[model samples]
Target chain A: MKSILLATTTFREAVRDRVFGLVAAFGLLLVLSTVIISPLTVGARGKIVTDIGLASISLFSLLMVLFVGSGMVHKEIDRRTIMTILSKPISRLDYLLGKYLGLWATLFVMMAAMTLIFACACALTEAEWKPTYLVALGMALCEMTVVTAVVVFFSSFTTPVLTSLFTLATFIVGHAIGDLERFAMVTGSAGMERAADISRFVLPNLDLFNVRNAVVHDLPVHSEHVVWAVVYALLYSAVLLAISDLLFRRREFK
Target chain B: MMTVLELRSVSKSYRSDFLFRRMPALTDVTFDVAAGETFAYLGHNGAGKTTTIKSLLGLIRVDAGNIRVFGHAPGTMAAKRRLGYLPENPYFYDHLTAREFLHLAARLNDMNRSDAKHRADQLLALVKMDHKANVRLRNFSKGMLQRVGLAQALIGDPELLVLDEPMGGLDPVGRYEVRRILEELKSRGKTLFMSSHILADVETLADRAAILNGGTLRRLVDLHELGHQERIMDLKFTQLSEAMVGELVRRGYPVERRAEAHHVLVEEHFAMAGLIDELVRSGSRLLRAAPHRVSLEEIFLREVERDVGQTPEDLLHRTVDELVGATSVKEESTP
Candidate 1:
């Protein structure tokens, strides 16, 4: 019960911050830019909008997850508010979970708002709402799980600036997992292949949640595939959160 | 009797630099706060007061010994439920109103929705902050912020309150109000362990005070014993001639002649009663006579200074004995 309240409180506090406004602006501009870029494609207006929307959501969400989520614990400690929270009956794990849930909820709210705007634009322009929009949102939610996990992992025992840098690097590496593995196979270098193998397992394969190609090209998305991706996201989030909780439990409040 | 909190020879050391040797923050510091007692933990800056508080709260792990707060480990939730703590410099969510912040704290302490709201209201009102309950805490004055902090600490109606400098930044009026509230808590049979450098407030408010310096327990002043010092009798009369002074001196009284008046100091407190009666009977004019006791501030300063270079173990025991003796002195000197 306490952890839930803590999580809710964190969510409320984050919404009041300036980053939420900036992320919203970025989301809105991305959606408008898609509208302008749509006419430039031949026989692929739908594909163009889908590509732009997916990329825009990923970019903005990564920023929210990396920058905003990364600062959740740091700000609490920096402001000395953790002392007040921990002085109560709450445990360190509960506080950490609260922080994770709070930032995750904030990201959800931001993504939900941007998704609705993008959906509205797609509907008005095409004169029909695509069911793929819901699928895209579901994929976006799964992707957030991984993004939030990475942010949380970096946030543990690291500064906000450093965490942001590392999380962004992880995001880039996560997106290149397939390419790196393919490159390693082609290069036939044992060391590089071993590095690629380790990187694939260690980093989040954000590409798994990258459903733009399927949604834009009108390709079929299997139910089992979506389920598998959701499961991976959930497991990844739990692992990262567990690690974060461990690091945070030992951290002395300043 | 169950001790509300006990620190059994706890010690903590902090390394000065990443590569340097460790500096002891507390050395074999031990004390217990029983239920319903106000224990004043006093010390100057760099003293072990804050370290002790942190150890009790389990914020800093002790290098040696044990601490039992309410019969449970300090960091355990079971013990924490019965404890309310106010950090020295309390930090709260700036965007949250006083009421919201306290309510949030209450909820986190496992108070149900309605109970949390009612308790938050009662606490805010108790701190005289009900008027500003709706105002964002960031805009609050320091005193108001401290009051809100105090209210938050009291959310669970904690059995033991560990206040670290709760009165530090408050104005005189705020300090008095806080003292009054603490006394009221004491009346309710709650244990309070408060830390502060303001000796006067500690002297006035604490039932028993333990002083520390350089992470060592210098003294444990039982104010009850310290209060035993008697109010001395002082008599002022018109200046007496040398012969008159000599005559009065022969009466077994300590008489000193001043330029304008004569001071008659008596060791026997009731001597005032006898002298006053004799003076009236003899038709002698009585200028003024009054009783006074030395302030605790004087004793605290003197004792602390005297024990500056003493070992922690000896200092603790000596101060405890002196406190007992001081109280007996008060009881003896009262007439």
Candidate 2:
């Protein structure tokens, strides 16, 4: 109950933030930018429109998660508002989870808005209403969930500036984990190979959520892969949230 | 009466970058607030008052000790349900109006929707914030914010209200309004554990106060005792001559001769009978005698200076300088 109250409050505050307004505005502009840019494609205007629209949504969502989510906890601490909230009946874990869910809800709203605009753009461009676009968007949302968790985790203990930097680094590294493994196999150095192997397990495999190419090229993505992606995103997010809760629990607000 | 809150031998230390040199924020601090009593925790800056409050609220874990709120460990849901806290320099969600903020606090305490709304209204009225209830907190003045903060603290109808500098950042009228609200809370039998540097407010509101200095409990003052204990006695007499004054001064009384009367400052334990006898024998007419106790401010300064190894005059000077600096900064930001 307390968590719900906190989450509601967090969502309200986040939506009211000027950064959210700016992000939404920029996201819409990016979606519409595809309208102007797609006609320049020589053959596949529909493909170009859907592809850019999905990528635009993914990129803007990641930007929102990285910049806005990074400050969710740090701002509370900096402004000393966390003291009042935590002093209530709510536990630190509840507060952390509430913030995560609240930001996630905001991300959901952003995704829905951008997807609607993207679908409209596709229809205007006479693009086929493929189920693959929705799948790609769903996976994109999952990717954002993972990234938001990473942002919250870093925001729990570090400054917003450092959290933004660290979360961005994590997102890049998470996506590259598969390539890192391949690179490690090609390298002859034992230490490099061992380090790469360890990172593959430690860092999240964000590549699982990247079904954009399959969707854009009209290739079939297996339901099993989608299930695994969902499971991995949920599990990875839970671990990050647990670590955030631990750090937040031990934190002393001076 | 029940003990609403207790802190037993609580100590906390913060580690700096310097190796093996921990800064002690609180050391062996122990005190308790009885049910329905207004307990003031007094200290200067860095005197561990805030640290103790945070420890009791479980915002920070103690290095060694125990804290119980309503006989349960603090930070537990059961205890927190009965606790409402107003932090110093409170920063609320600026996007929220006063009513929404209070409702949020009420719901977090598990109040039903209708009850939360009712209580928020009641508290807003109690703090005289009903007029601004619909305004966003970002547009509020400091005093308005403090009032709304107080309203939120009272939203749950908490049995214990832990306020850290509740009157901070308020003007004189705002402070008076806050004190009146606290007085009302006291009348309703709410236990108040307040930490404040405002000695006048403490003297006016607190039943008992504990002074902390240098991370240690310096003195616990029972204001009730001041009504019975005489600290200083003022004696007035007429027809006081220079020779009589000399005699009185020689007899160890601090006598200041006025044109119409002679004023004698007597120690609390001085022999009043002997002094009167002397006055009568000297044919000086007695005017009046009165006893006075030292003010809370005086005692606070004495304790703070004693802890810092400075004279009261020096401390007062430094305090004035600091206040001036603070005022200038505030002025710079006023526009």
Interface CA RMSD, all predictions: 1.4, 1.0
Compare the candidates by DockQ and give the number of the best one: 2
User: TM-score, each model?
Assistant: 0.81, 0.88
lDDT (Cα, tens digit) per residue for candidate 1, span B276-304: 67654554556888653444654555456
Q: Residue B304's C-alpha lDDT in candidate 1?
A: 60
User: Each prediction's Cα lDDT score?
Assistant: 0.77, 0.82
Tens-digit lDDT track for model 2 on A1-254? Answer: 67777778778887877546645675567556666776777878777777777778888898888877888888888888898888888899989988898889888988888887777777776667787789999999999999999988998998999999988888889899888878877887788788888877888788889999998887899999999999999999999899899998888987
Flag regions of model 1 displaced more than 4 Å: A31-47, A124-129, B227-335
